[model samples]
Target: MSQLISIPESYESLNLTHINIAHHPPQSPTATPIVILRLNRPDKNNAFTPQMGESLEQAYRLFHLDARVKVIVLTGAGRMFCAGSDLDIGFDDRVERAGDFRDTGGRVALAMHRCSKPTIAALQGSAVGVGMTMTLPAAIRICHEKSKYGFVFTRRGLTIESCASFFLPRLIGMSKAMALITTGGVYPGLSKYFGELFTEVLAEGTAVLPRALEIAREMAENVSPLASYMSRALMWQGPTSPEGAHLLESKVFHHMAGQSDYKEGVNSFLEKRKANFLCDPYEMSPGDYPWWSEVDIRVGPKASKSKL
Candidate 1:
């Protein structure tokens, strides 16, 4: 007999918009237990603002902390899963305050990468720039045949962020990463050639989101929660040496302990209230200084200056 675990009633009443982050959920449960997180801003082609980024980070944190959630299905709303950063919105003033925008994306990516639960991204349309990077930390990806993936950093006169510099090459090989990063070209048939990058490639117009939900439900229903959790932890920890993993764990532990969100998370669960996290620990601190010094191109020897 399948062991039945009842989802908390509070889960139903809690703001799905906040938790879902995209205001969409599966129509019904599936074979695997699943949590669906949708990116709601379809009007902007699901462009990620700083708030959206923080919301995503928080949503993942919530899923990780919840004993009930076994797997996560990440997708976006409207025609595109995500169109990348919102250039139309202008630079966020907080970007200056945060010092390095890369850190914001890096922290979120680290959280996703280190999560003890598996994550799957369902891609239907365009996933560009950070949208592309966001999918990197996912354990699996399912994309519709026609969906397009691109790395648009160079086009924007910027370099890759979100630890893509480290993670992308590891996944797709250095040459491929360089080609994509340098040229800013969209890669079709990515899911086919790079199955590791995408676990499955669906038929064109196959409804990617529905498939993701189905998978999530199946995982939830069939898998043993404890075993799945342990397996996830093992997989996350297996890559590093015990000493290195312990150090990393300690850093996250200490950081979380110092944050208000840590307290809010516990108190909210105990008091049965929605957690309103006061601080975003994922934001980059201003103290990080760049290691590379700027080059003085003009200091190079001028063509005729040495003639005398």
Candidate 2:
């Protein structure tokens, strides 16, 4: 049975116009915070709008800057997660030149990608086009077994957006990614073409968000925020060679070993108690923490500067 999802009395709300930001406190005082970012346009199947995209990007940037937030859960408000872009509203007509235009969906994806906090996507129902691509940056995705998903851009005679081309292949494999884009067809959450895209699939749509929250709460309580973020970054940007990987790992370990979290981890292990890790990895990163070069998706290459 799908359980009721009630926000505890202690939770705080940001009450943003396009999206809802809920600040969920941890069970223990020492644990890190969890934030839920939900798409609020339930009336339109939570259709993607320029305002919604801006709100999402803002929330992600806030999460990146705030040390209090450890985990983020992305979900939609109603029966359908999102039915892709709000086609009636159409694309932004503000741009004067095509060369200067930047995709809002891509900007949202970039924000999510840049954020260090681990994100979990709770897909309670079908998600199409930009809706599907937005969740690609999340570390984990939990979905309803009956919920459908689609790339859908080709069917609409539109190209893919939201950095899907890069993340999709790396996540599911090149062949599967190619298939999804080529056909632009809707498929169930458990479809063979999707492979292992969803980390967990629950039978009930109502159960999906709750299951994601359960996992997020567990992570907030037991996992080190710093370690989790770094581990993800390492996997996504690690060196290809064995020797390079070994050297990089050694360097990172040496730096981390001197931090407060390492001592707390060791002492807690020895004392048979839960660890109270308080280190902020972003603030205390190694001199060369982000070894790879970063691309600025916001601007053209000629005008862009390296993030690293």
Candidate 3:
């Protein structure tokens, strides 16, 4: 419906030339909706570039705004997921002051994190440096057992980027995270050192994307968009203290009880039918929705008006 891998007319303003956007089901009027974003430069081994990062940020922002989108699938074209940054055009050449400039990978990761839709990364081949770190924000990662992954920052004389400092340890535990960082070595997707980084590691490289798509389809068909988003958000941004968490949970319960989906959810369960959850969670956000303040984090890159 949207010209296969080409950007949809609705998304033209975003100038997403670096990535391909395709809608699952290929029809506009469908209950089950999923969007796929592919890193489009297979010729270059799907290397990460500033343009790619900007396009990804734009896509994630679009996903956040579109209520019809249920799940997002991120993967690369051809064989490799990503080979880290395009080293030919190094990141150190930026003209902005060190304090003012934000790394592209970090910005892209934040955008992915802020998106309300569930996201899955399909790593069909090896991923290194920025590629691996960027996928850390995804809710799930499906990888090929033979695919290699690395946190190769130390080898490049750099520290971590893409908010990996926050997400990597939380995902794989401190010991594994520290070991990976310290070694800066590439390991198989099924490595015990990664803990739970990859939700499913299939034996075949071709199976990774299919498995990711299956999971995305299942999520899109069954999960309540509002409830799913809230659950993830709360888990990531909840209060530290048990008393504070309890208070926040009570407030959320009170707020959700007033929404239409709450009644629909209850009625559907009582009647033994699929619940039609149509409420837009952002629109129905509670008064203290963002209980915590976001300081200087940039949510999205500026969209370009020019056509790609």
Candidate 4:
């Protein structure tokens, strides 16, 4: 049994101070701690507010800086994962403040994408609009066999938000993605056809949270944090061509193949014991961590067409 970690009573953004932060024991003695980030709005079906968006970004930062948090399992407190944005509170600060362009949902999605730690969304109940789009960037999304979900943008006369265009198609394929966005209907899950969208499904909503903890414990116990973070970054941020991917992989290999963690892993394998990987992920990462610096695009001189 691992001792529970206590968070300070000071995270004030996005109502994060009220979030249920709990630690679950590792499946094995070697596993690190698993943190649960539960949405605390059972009354509103855990709807997203601008405050919630602020909290999400801050929460991720907290997770990244904390060495004890190996993995994050995101779930809701009520029967539903999230009921999308809170419609009852009818104000337009999120849009008006952003010059009438930025969607708060997209901000939350960007926050999730920016997080270095592995994220798993445990969808116990219905999630629509921002609720559904927000989970698209998670490393893994788990739900019950018959869990409810929705795209709900077109139906609400609002276009898709939360940058789902970049993530949804990549996840469920373009054809299904288009249909879901356009149709905008709530649907039940656990279909054998859409296996990629779901990492694993439980028998019921009640089991989703427990199953997420189990999966998180598996990752915390057996996986090296540095390797996992780097791998995830490469998968999302690496170049388009196979050669580009190879180059990035080679760079990461060069950076990680000779580190202390690598040596410990080798020695542990030879000794037939659980490896104690002590290397911090941030330290193990190459310069600037993600290492994908943007370069200015150069245009070629235009060739004037001569009459032929």
Model 1: CA > 4 A from native: 1-32, 90-102, 190-195, 225-308
Which parts of model 2 have CA positions greater than 4 angstroms off? 1-15, 25-32, 298-308
Top candidate on TM-score is 3
Error of 4 at 146 (Å): 2.1
For 247-299, candidate 1 gives per-residue lDDT tens digits of 54455446456656567668878998665544422241112211124333232
lDDT (CA) for every model shown?
0.64, 0.84, 0.85, 0.76
Prediction 4 TM-score vs. true: 0.84
Against the true structure, candidate 1 reaches a TM-score of: 0.65
lDDT of residue 77 for candidate 1: 75
What is candidate 3's local distance difference test score? 0.85
Single out the weakest 10-residue window by summed lDDT for candidate 1. Answer: 282-291
lDDT value for candidate 4?
0.76
Q: lDDT per residue, candidate 2, 4-100, as tens digits?
A: 3332333244445668877655343332378778898999999999989988887777677677778899999989998899999976747756777
lDDT of each residue in 75-193, candidate 3, tens digit only: 99999999999998776436544665688999899999988887899999999999999999899999999989999999999999999999999898999999999999999988988
Query: For model 4, how does the per-residue alpha-carbon lDDT over 239-277 read when each residue is reduced to its tens digit?
Result: 899999998899888888878888888888899988777
Superposed model 4: Cα runs more than 4 Å off? 1-18, 26-32, 90-101, 191-195, 294-308
